[model samples]
Target: MARIRVQNLVKAWGDFRAVDDIDFETNDGEFVALLGPSGCGKSTTLRLIAGLDQATSGQIFIDDRDVTQVAAAKRNLALVFQSYALFPHLSVADNITFGLSVRGVPRAERERRLEKTASLLGVTALLGRKPSQLSGGQQQRVALGRALISEAPVCLLDEPLSNLDAKLRAEMRNEIRTLQQRLGITMVFVTHDQTEAMSMADRVILMKSGKVEQCGTPAELYENPASTFVAGFIGTPPMNLVAAAPKDGRLAVAAAASSDLVLGVRPEHIEFAGEGQEAVVAGSEYFGADTVVACRIGEQKLMVRVPGRPGLGTGAQVRLAWAPSNEHAFDARSGLRKSA
Candidate 1:
């Protein structure tokens, strides 16, 4: 579709800035996710891009054309909200064709668009079904179909999958990705779910308090976080962070019960050893494929994912160790990475 460029954007409410001056770009056919905690300005950024709300300052460019002041209708973007927003009284076909019909697209063109979209979304038989008759996941598909029928290069989704159950959400993630790639639309997704962002995005925009904490490929943020906030936010069984000092020729993890430095290792990257950093078992979680072992070394704890290690049950004594390279060094006071 079209490339979208956001430059030095700012959005404010009275004296409080909801979205700080930020810069980013989404390439043609790219699927970028704006991820953050609640009230972090991710949704505000989406509204700004969709022209649902105006920016307080800065510019927005779609296909290199300035449209910061464009009306939402003029921008021609397809936006799906967290709620499906489908018309309960309208049949699936009517819902999908509403956009075209409103724009005065002739019957022939509308039918053509509807046919292509229904087939793409596998809702051909669903045409006569009203929103109430369809399942939640199906309703979401129709919502997306409505957008797809627009054939706009840019698509904005505001947590379109949030309303579904876990299974439906999982299924829809793949469906959305497949459809996005098939249509080759430049899509901007806004969600507070880190797993969704990490699983589906081409690049992630991690936001905090209206400012960008970091923007990078999932691997980049997981491996080399720019700040302590990111370090704690990006991983499953997140990186271990404890206060530590690089002294006495070795670092002590202070949270590891007053050890020297905070030790950062992935849950899957840690190993149990007798001679390694001494720790007591704080907790354990067992999954069939693997078991997660949480070891408390001094006052701090680290989680390690191990396979076939049921022998080391909860409260068991063990030594936690990781490859030197697996360890991350952070400033004792700042908690920001000292070295990647």
Candidate 2:
């Protein structure tokens, strides 16, 4: 296993910068995920680390060695691409052993490694089949097996499960996490999906506009977001942000109709209170186990999540309340969390 460090990394295309001076480090055997929406530089950062794309400026380190200028082939890291990048004509065993073959590894050693990787990925029976003959999940396993057979200290994955169905994606998330833990390889996974990053990564490096937004464990970003963008990006229904002022222990419109404060409360945090902020129910969605009600406080909208069906109807008058500790305050001008 190896610790990967990216210091002052920058990637640019002409005048447009894709990654801007981003810095972070992954511990040995740690799973770090780069997460953000499309065009947010997560993929660019990953490619830079893989040596697939040259950075405009910065340095990359694998363990104690400076590999900023190292060739991709010499980096000694396994990479699993988004498309699986398998040769359709080759059987699973051949695909997995291609790296070994290229390196002229002994035939017996290659076979031994192949056996272990196949067993670990549960693709022992599919060794003779081509990628085209395999299911999506099976193909993903073969792709992973290819990387595992390399026995590299670092493993990098680029949206490896995005092509799978929702159920398969969830399954693969667990499988990949388990495989990383079992192998103790330092991993860097890039994904636009927040759920995948939160569920699979030991730590998440949230990015925006080619810059580092926040880097922390999943719980840290969810419970204590550093900025309004993160507050709106991390949750299922997202946190409800309303422009309001603290009034008589409740949030309400300011008498002056001007305030730089925004109150953030997660949909799950807002509860039905008899004495709270008055709002009109604009819409409600039933999700079998829970219901999300969209409430309108004047022109602003907020969502309230409740267990089961609340039978809330449109235009119904309701008061939304939440615990003091549950409320997050942000400055409207800067869109950053306000210190209490």
Candidate 3:
């Protein structure tokens, strides 16, 4: 396993900067996720680390050795691309051993690694098949095997599970995490899906507009979001950010406060109470396990998550209440969280 460090990294093309002054480090054997929406530079950052893309400025260090100027092949990093990038003409066994063959590894050594990697990924039976003959999940395993055969200290994955269906994606998530732990390999996973990032990574680096927005454990980011963007991005239905006014040294949702402050509360934190702030139900979405009721308070709207079907119809009035400890405050002007 190896530790990775990126110092003031920047990647630019012409007048546009794809990555801007980013800095973060990963512990040995840690799973770190670079997470953000499209064009946020998460993929670009992974490319830079893999040496597939050069950093416009800054340094990259792996295991305390500077590798910023090194070529991709010499960096000793195995990368699993989003597309799986399998060769149509090659068998799964051949695909997995391609790296070793290219490096002039002995046929016997290659066979040994192929057997071990195949068994570890549970793809030994598929080794005789061509990529076109396999399912999406099977092809994904082959791609993973290709990376794992190298036994590299660091593995970089760029949305490796995006091509699969929801159920398969969930299965692969657990498989990949288990593999990483079993081998104690440091992994840097890039994804736009907040669920993947939060559920898989030991730590997450959330990016926005080509720069790091916040980097912390998933719990840290969820329980203590650094800004309005994070508050709205991390959760399933996201945090409800409503206009708020200062009321007796506390914040309360109001239309007039849109200029001064924003109050944030997760959908799960809100509950229906006999007496609280008055709101009119706008709509409800019923999932098997829970229901999300949309309510409007003046000009602001928020969603409340309640177990089972609340059966609240449109235009129904309800009073909402939440614990003070669950409330989050942010400056409306700057969109930054207000400090305690």
Candidate 4:
């Protein structure tokens, strides 16, 4: 296992800077995820670590060794691609052992490592099968088994689960997390999906415009976002940001004007307050155990995720309230939080 450190990393293509100066480090055996939307420079960062793309400037250190100029094949690191790059004619056993054979490892040692990796991945029985005969999830396990047999101290996964169905993706995520912890290999996963990053990462590196927006554990980014962009980007149904004004000591949301500030609240944070319903119900979506209520306060829209919610029709009067602790205040100019 190895700790991965990326310091002052920058990648640029001509005048277009793909990755700005970004600094992040992961402890040995820590599963850190690089998360961002498309064109946010996550993939570029991964390629830099994998030695596939040269950085414009900066360094990457694995196990305290500076490997900024190391070739991908010589880095002693494993990078699994989304394509599941399995050879067509090779059986699972052959595919897993190919790297070892190419590296000139003895047959006995290769078999031993192959057996261990197969057992770790629960793919021992599938060794005789070809890629065409296996399901997507099974094929993914074979890919993982191949990487594991390499015994690389660091593993980089580039949207490895993107090819699987939703249900299988969820199942495999936990499985991968278990395997990662059990084997104690430091892992860095790259994905645009927030749910994947939130579920699998020990810590998340949130990026935007080739820059580090925020980096923290999933709960930190979700509960105390540093900016309106982070708050809006990190949540499901996202956060409800309204143009707000300070009314006396109470915060007032406007439909007609922006009086005081822009106050943000998550959908799950807003509670339904009844015919004292000061806001209008613009829409409601039923989801068996809970409903997502879309309330309009002035000209702004705020969604509230309420469980076992009472039926409220469109134009139904309702009031919205968020706990003081759940409220996030941001600076209008910088778009950064007033306080963490």
Candidate 5:
């Protein structure tokens, strides 16, 4: 329905740059996530796209039409804020149809659209209640209904699930994804949660320090991170990055080589073996489905994910092995992935 593009976008406050020269585009009807930690500019990027904040420089295009100077209301975009900004004094029905009334859409049309959106989001029964009377999840649905009632082709969400509990967040994630697909609307979501971005988005734009770090599909990011920052950020237990050196024409931990080179391996890739690099167990955490074992190869720490509980005690010596192909090499100084 809509394709959004931002080119060389930047947002600055005097000496500070919140968003710095970022470029990315979303396919029509695609789900894209802006993911990063706090102060990383993901929310700023989303606001720039929604026309809520003006960019310091660059162009914004919607369906190939330049909307850099367009007003937020004139852009034909709907936004759902993280706080679920509903008026407490207004009933759910009135809140959902408020925008329509402000734009002077006829009462009949407003009611018709409100009914359709309420049904779509399963909030029709709560139309008479006020925001204060609704639970968090219900309030979220009402907020979504307000956005959807506009029938806008482009929707922007800013950490919409952050306020909900874990179970509710999971439920809303699926619901929102389903709604996007069912309506064929393009969506840009902002979140710091890697799980949310990896599970929902068709692609993820990971940001750091106001710059674009990596942009790719979830599988691509997981399989091949561009830097040590990405390697440490995208996983549940994250990748284990330890000092390494060249030994026997191959890289080995604690060997004498360039101190500027680092080795990265996913927690799930490392395995306990009969003979390999030796390590001492530091501790482990059991998560029912699997266990995350913390081990140290010399002074550097590594986390290994293993199936079931190994029941290894602290100070226990173990041999760790992983396929060479599973290893990732990075330049320690630059934090960039090293070419094989």
Candidate 6:
């Protein structure tokens, strides 16, 4: 595969910048996900790297070769789009071989590559089926087979599993990640789904308002977010952040003079203690494996995740506490994480 580098990348239209100056690097065979909400510029950045769109002012290097101005067809990168983009009229085999055939690859070579790809993706029998005859997961596999057969060192997927059902999506996530590791191909995935990015990527690049909010391994971003936005955006049930001030040597929602600090804790970290912050249970959400209790401490709200089921119910008084190390401090005014 290839190492990818983006230096001072910027993409603008008129006065609005879709992608502000951002820089990051991906090592050979590394899987990196560009993750953000809609309109956050993740897709634009991917387009820039794939040469589908030109950067306003910056450089892109693949394997240490400058290709900021190179044509997309010359980039030697395979792209799998969100829709799978399979031709409805073409059989699976024909769809997968279209690219090879266009480049005049010999029949035997094309067949060899197709066989290997189909076997790798578990889509050998699907070759005779048309797009309409295959299930969503099967279609996805065919699309992947098509991309893999190209044998491009770099693969770019734009929400490749978004169209699948929840169960299929999970299965595909594991399958794709395993295949990616097995093939040792560098992968750049673009998706707005945090879980998809967090679970499937080796590293995550979180973006916000066209800027890189944070870039780190999944655990790094979750445990040591650089900003309040990152903390709120990276977790399941999310980290609980409440405006607070120090009171009686402990933290409270506020006092006469509110402190600039905010208290941040994960849902799973909060616990019931004999002595701690006082709160009232407002409600609860029950998932199959766990339950989340919504608590109200003063005018602020916090969520607590408890295994199985929690005894707390609406309007129930409770003492909330957590390990001192679990309490993350942040600057309320700047919305940035504070130094420990």
**Top candidate, metric lDDT:** 3
What is the per-residue lDDT of model 1 for residues 126-178, given as tens digits with 9 covering 90 to 100?
99998999998888989999998999999999988889999989999999999
Candidate 3 per-residue C-alpha lDDT over 46-79 given as tens digits, one digit per residue, 9 for 90 to 100: 9999999999999999998999999999998999
Considering lDDT, which of the candidate structures 5 and 6 is the better prediction for this target? 5
**Model 3: residue 93 alpha-carbon error in angstroms:** 0.9
Residues 66-164, model 6: lDDT tens digits: 999999888899988888999999999999999999999999999999899899889998899999999989999998988889999999998888899
Residue 100 displacement in candidate 1 (angstroms)? 0.6
Q: Which candidate is the best by TM-score?
A: 3
C-alpha root-mean-square deviation, each candidate: 2.0, 1.6, 1.0, 1.7, 1.3, 1.7
Judging by lDDT, tell me the better candidate of 2 and 4.
2
Sort order, lDDT high to low: 3, 5, 2, 6, 4, 1
For model 5, give the RMSD to the true fold. Answer: 1.3
- Model 1 CA lDDT for position 17: 95
lDDT of 5 by residue, 29-50 (tens): 9999999999999999999989
Q: Report the lDDT tens digits of candidate 4 across residue range 190-266.
A: 98899899989999999999998999999999988888888888878898877776665655576664544678888
Report, for every candidate in turn, its global Cα lDDT versus the true structure: 0.86, 0.92, 0.94, 0.88, 0.94, 0.90
What would the per-residue lDDT of candidate 2 be over residues 1-340, giving only the tens digit for each residue?
8999999999999999999999999999999999999999999999999999998999999997999999998999999999999998899999999999999999999999999999999999999998999999999999999988999999999999899999999999999999999999999999999989999999999999999999999999999999999999899998877787987765664334347988889999889899977889999999999999998887788889999999888999998788888888889898899877
Question: Higher TM-score: candidate 2 or 4?
Answer: 2
| Runs off by more than 4 Å, candidate 4 | 257-260, 274-277
Give per-model TM-scores: 0.94, 0.97, 0.98, 0.95, 0.97, 0.96
Look at candidate 5 and tell me the lDDT of residue 266. Answer: 95
lDDT of model 6, residue 272 = 78
User: Which prediction has more favorable TM-score, 1 or 6?
Assistant: 6
10 residues in a row with least lDDT, candidate 1: 255-264
Worst lDDT window (10 residues) for model 6?
Answer: 249-258
